[model samples]
Target: MKVKTLEKLAKDMIDYIINLSGFEHIEDIQLNVVDNLESGDMAECNYNDSHGYIQLNIASNMINDIEQAKYVISHELGHILTREFHTYYVNFVGLDDDDMTSICSNVYEQTAEILAKRLGRLILKLYEQKDK
Candidate 1:
């Protein structure tokens, strides 16, 4: 797909995400399309704690594949959603400072991946229905 088309779709996906339950209170994920990623990954989610905003970066290479792009975006949305909930989890768990680093990263990533794929498919289905 073209960059313009991808941008529109990304906007739509972000809008869909923001309207969801936990995500409604937080900042919407911002889309940043770059020519290439330093890590050589297709995409990743970056959350700025200070500003309370999430940035979703999509590698220019993967933007051509709508499916891949959708997954990347949705996956990052999953991260945002998970991050939001994790904040509450942290309050309850009373985890040690040292343990938090490992637990937060591992647990959230795993959970986000699962939720992203499932939610991504659902989003795509919604799009399909609209198109029909």
Candidate 2:
């Protein structure tokens, strides 16, 4: 995906994450745009006891398609919302043109993706509603 499109997706997804987390005071989530990332995926997140941010790499050639892109965002959102390790986030995001099936490392990751998808759907619906 183009940097501009990826940037918009990242922002929208992060806003959804913040709203879903319901941490009223801590609503400032961030998204980073990188030309290249170690993982040939669309997004990644690093979270810990203190602070964290989600990084979306626009250079990932695999995200050229839209469905892959949606899964990528949902997977990354899983990392932030589920607090999964930054370890497997790369696979979670998948490649832009790669398979849509999830690459979950563990049960928690699977769980997170499930929840992220559900929440992501709701958020996107709301976004669409407002667009009308």
Candidate 3:
């Protein structure tokens, strides 16, 4: 797909998810489709809590089509939705140079991944239903 078309789809998906997910307080969300990410990741989301904004970057070369783009974007959205849980878990358990801390971090990542897959499918289903 073309870059412009991909960007528009991503933006629309983001807006739809935020509106349905009670994330209306988020004032700004920018999408960047880059050639590559320094971390070699498919996508990443950078959120500035103080500014109430999120910068979502997707590696253009990594995504092949609309389905992949939807999944990648929703995964980042999953991170945003689950930030509070991650923070609470980290704060409650405390972070240090320990195996437990590493485990906790892994758990948080896995949680986001799981939520992303489910949320992506749900969003698509709901969107289709709405169209009907």
Candidate 4:
């Protein structure tokens, strides 16, 4: 699909997820489809705590289809949604910021990936049901 189309898809998915999940506190959500990311990542989500908004960046070249795009978008959203739980688990385990090295970050990433996959499947199911 075209870059503009992908951007629109991302925005629509974000709105759908927020409405379905009743996720609040986000003042705005921005979507950017870039040729490539500096980190060589397919997609990334940056949350601005001060502004209560999220910046979602997707590497246009990395997305091959609508399904892949949705997965990437949902995965980034997963990061935003699961952040609090990840922090709580880290603290409950008596780990401080200093202890959050690559390993800790990897754990959080894995958790986010798992949750994102589940969420993506659920969203697809719900969306299909809604149309039926």
Which lDDT tens digits does candidate 1 get at residues 55-126? 777777656687777766766666666665545544665435456467665675467578777766776565
Candidate 2 similarity to native, TM-score: 0.55
Per residue, candidate 4 scores C-alpha lDDT tens digits across 12-128 of 777777787778754566778888889799898765554556677899887888888876777777766665655565556544546557676668667767887786677756544
Q: Per-residue lDDT tens digits of candidate 2, residues 28-51?
A: 345666666777655665443334
Model 3 residue 31 CA deviation in Å:
2.3
Residue clash pairs of candidate 4: none
Q: Provide backbone clash counts, one per model.
A: 0, 3, 0, 0
Model 4 score (lDDT): 0.71
lDDT of each: 0.66, 0.56, 0.71, 0.71
For 5-82, candidate 3 gives per-residue lDDT tens digits of 668877787777778888756566778877788979988877555565668888877778888777677667777666
Task: Write the candidate numbers in order of decreasing lDDT.
Answer: 3, 4, 1, 2
Using Cα atoms with residue i matched to residue i, what is each candidate's TM-score against the true structure?
Answer: 0.68, 0.55, 0.75, 0.73
Model 3 clash pairs are none
Which candidate's TM-score is highest?
Answer: 3
**Model 2, CA-based lDDT:** 0.56
Model 1: which ten-residue window has the lowest total lDDT?
88-97
- Worst ten-residue run, lDDT, model 4? 90-99
